[model samples]
Target: MTPTIPGFDYQRVQVAEGIALTTAVGGSGSPIVLLHGFPQTHLMWRDVATDLAADHTVICPDLRGYGASDKPADPDGTAYAKRTMAADIVTLARALGHERFALAGHDRGALVAFRAGLDHPTSISHLACLDVLPTLDMWQVMRGTNAAVGFHLYLMAQPSGLPEQMIAAAPDAFFGHFLDIWTHDPDAIPADIRAAYLDACRHAVPSIVADYRASARIDVDHDQADKDADNQLDMPVTVLQQDWGAALGFDARALWSAWAPKLAHTTVTCGHFMAEEAPAQITAELRKLVDR
Candidate 1:
């Protein structure tokens, strides 16, 4: 059986034509939607969601193409664009009876949440992004040898066939690499949960690549346009990130501040998978963000 967040009700909700997101919802009060990152699912938010469920209605959803969510083919390359994914989130929240709600996302999900805040300013009451830079800043900072750390990003950003085939050929090794290296605490992701994430990635290789590919191309264009237009996240924003900037030779907080004027940026000691590696810390930050 698949591992799941205890007490959370799982269901499929249509957010777009012919596309339904597999969502896990629990608790009851104000709503907050959590989006999972790459090579994982809504299950990544299991602990944090449960904790927040004590007071807030926590909605966790596998982003389109990642988990059991509908993975429509990207014939035009826009299918997995963050703008498109962000719209799906807006529609998903409205479908679940929330015209507006607090939003938080980690890693790839953070990219989506960032786009959502820019595109649907009024729909997101509070915004929190965990462990990711905006797409444009991300590309800008990753230079020369430092870019080697994100080799997977370049690989997936390649045109169509090659990246998909390469990843699909050995999905376990491809997905497992991140799972192994990105966590600070091994016990944070027990064997069962890791297996669940691997299994989900194994089945969704093409869609996952498409998502990364969009980031390299169309997503950058979208972010650039917003930057050019002086558009900013007009909401209370909290950012939790590892001190990647120091290692990568860029200021993470300063880069984030360029977009989020009302921003609270913190350098976390945990690894990239801070949600799992530091759930208590993640939960506390999220609660503070909502209150902000």
Candidate 2:
């Protein structure tokens, strides 16, 4: 059976000059665009999107490089930057007839959602970020041994060739490693969906690496510029994470406060894949953001 978001109609829509995103659209009401994280696609939002679909138009997209979307090879890595990915979401929402929408993202998606909120404040009514810090904060906080926790980030950030070559040799293992280790519940993502995630990541090795590379390179430049400019998220912003700040001995809320002046930050014990491990809680927080 094809692994897909049940009841959601899938479409590939052009979001930029050379970029088109594969999106799953369903339900109807206040629009909410859900962005999936690394090595995963919109499938990450299966539970949360379906539940939220009852009341809102939930649009889930496989960010440009991660799924059945355009993966333009960018030597400078700007093509896969969160700035570019965020623009894809803005164009997608407008194309779907939503001039403005509520936005939520998990992991890498949260990164894009972060950029979207920063870059397209007028287009996002409320923003919810799951299991991630702003790019600038993410790089700042990971120090010494703590940085070891994100070995993949450093690995993929290397200039071309190596990461792609090594990961491509064992794509399933690379992608499946996160899908397995990042969650409190291994079965939270069932077999078929897991297979789909693995397959997608396996086939899109270079593009996925490019996406990560940009985070360490161009994405940071954009984020640092935003910071220097003192740009804050203009809308209500809610951040949900596994309390990495507490574990890593940093003030997570205090850090988020700098980016989101109006912020509601929550720490969950649901592990890294919070949307899947604790969908009800994730959905509730998202609903609250939209209502707020």
Candidate 3:
């Protein structure tokens, strides 16, 4: 069982046909769905969710093929596409009695939130993406030295069996590498929580690889189509990133402005796990979205 966030009730909600989401829900006010990132579960939102629960109903879910959620065998990348993942979240909130809600995501989840804002504009009232760029822009921005930071993206983007096979051999090290490298503080994640993450990854090799693979293939196709159509998110959007653009030689805000017209962009000093590294600040930012 996933460790329960304080004052939250856990549920395996059937959000679609044969798709059930492991969700953690708490508080009572306007709804806001929090999405977790790669190499972690909804538990990543514990501090932020509990803090926001004072005024907002926070819903955190393990995205499809992640954590304790239903992991369908989707080697083709179609099922793991952000389009499908975003639909899963939209369906989840509806099941929870929310027709429209605020949305925030970190890492992989942020990608899903990006899709949610584009595909289901009326469903999402406010959207926040932490520590990521859009899928197409992600590939465009990372080059040469900057690409080194995204080595896992290239590794996991490989053919179906290969990535999963290599990951299966040493799942702990493969996942824990990010756990160790992506954070500003080693002590930010509790030892017990780290162990849980490692243990989960050990058993989730294929599904997790499939999720990453989709990002490289089908997810990129979806994003490219959106770009070709000149599509943009028609919602109040907030972006908090670590300013990879500074080191990467690109204008992050310029890229994001193309997607989010009403954008509130800030460069956070924290690492990839900003929600954990700066929960108070993240919570305060989300509260601003709430007030807006």
Candidate 4:
């Protein structure tokens, strides 16, 4: 079944060589690129995109290894780095004729958005991150039994074949585990959306793992470089996260303030899948961010 989001026109473009990006472009005015997270495709933003597209041109793309985007083999971790992935968005935006645009990402996409804001500050007009902390803060906050909540981070962060093979053999279980556990309301995701994620992950296992592995090593250096440059998103930033990090020993808002000069940071009761679990609230928060 081809799932549809009302009011948005779906289009596929070859945004990168040997890799075509499946994007949904709709509405008018300034552009807002929406990036979806791990275990999901651009479809995760269906409802949110509709809301935003009424007045703003919303561009939602399946990040390189997810959704309908090309899952071309990137064996060396060269392209899957969020930095490179972030650049892809910039290229896609330029192709769409926007010199600068607002960006919002969820989960893995949040990390990518962070990279885009820091690395190409001039290209991203506004930044919004959903349901994730900065990578370094996430590393520091996980310790003891509290770390169990994010065991996949460590598992996927491990070196080489182990994590990849383990997940490949049981991709369904691996991806479904998150869908079942991460949501406070599983029904909020609906069956087709959940299946779409599992299907994408199963097919794009290597690329997905590469995305995580890059975070473990190269992404750290990327983040460190931004910190060293004292480069921050000059535009307004809105960070929405769950309160879980607090229980696990992290001040979510305070940490974000270090990277964003103008920030509206808050924690909600929603679980990891905030976009799906709390659509109304998430959409409202995004409206506030875009309007700001």
lDDT (Cα, 0-100) at 267 in candidate 1: 84
Ten-residue region with minimum lDDT total, candidate 1: 179-188
Residue pairs with backbone overlap in model 3? none
Identify the runs in model 3 with alpha carbons over 4 angstroms from their true place: none
lDDT of each residue in 1-292, candidate 2, tens digit only: 5588999999989988877889999998999999888778899899999999999999998888887888888876688898888888999999999999999998889999999999998999999988888888888999988788899999999999999999999888888898878878887888988888888888899999998999899999999999899999989999997877876778989999998889999988877888888999999999999999
Greater lDDT among 2 and 4 belongs to 2
Model 1 per-residue lDDT tens digits across residues 1-292 = 9999999999999999999999999999999999999778999999999999999999999999988899999999999999999999999999999999999999999999999999999999999999999999999999999999999999999999999899899899999999988888889999999999999999899899999999999999999999999999989999999988999999999999999999999988988999998999999999999887
Model 1: residues >4 Å from true position, as ranges? none
Model 2: lDDT equals: 0.89
Using TM-score as the measure, which candidate wins? 1
Model 4: which residue pairs collide?
Answer: none
Model 1 whole-model lDDT (C-alpha atoms): 0.94
User: How well is each residue in 165-263 modelled by candidate 3, as lDDT tens digits?
Assistant: 888998888899999988888888988788878877787788888888888998888899999999999899999999778888999999999999999
**Alpha carbon deviation, residue 193, candidate 4 (Å):** 1.1
Per-residue error for 244 in candidate 4, Å, reads 1.1
Task: List runs of model 2 lying over 4 Å from the truth.
Answer: none
TM-score of each: 0.99, 0.98, 0.98, 0.96
Off by over 4 Å in 4: none
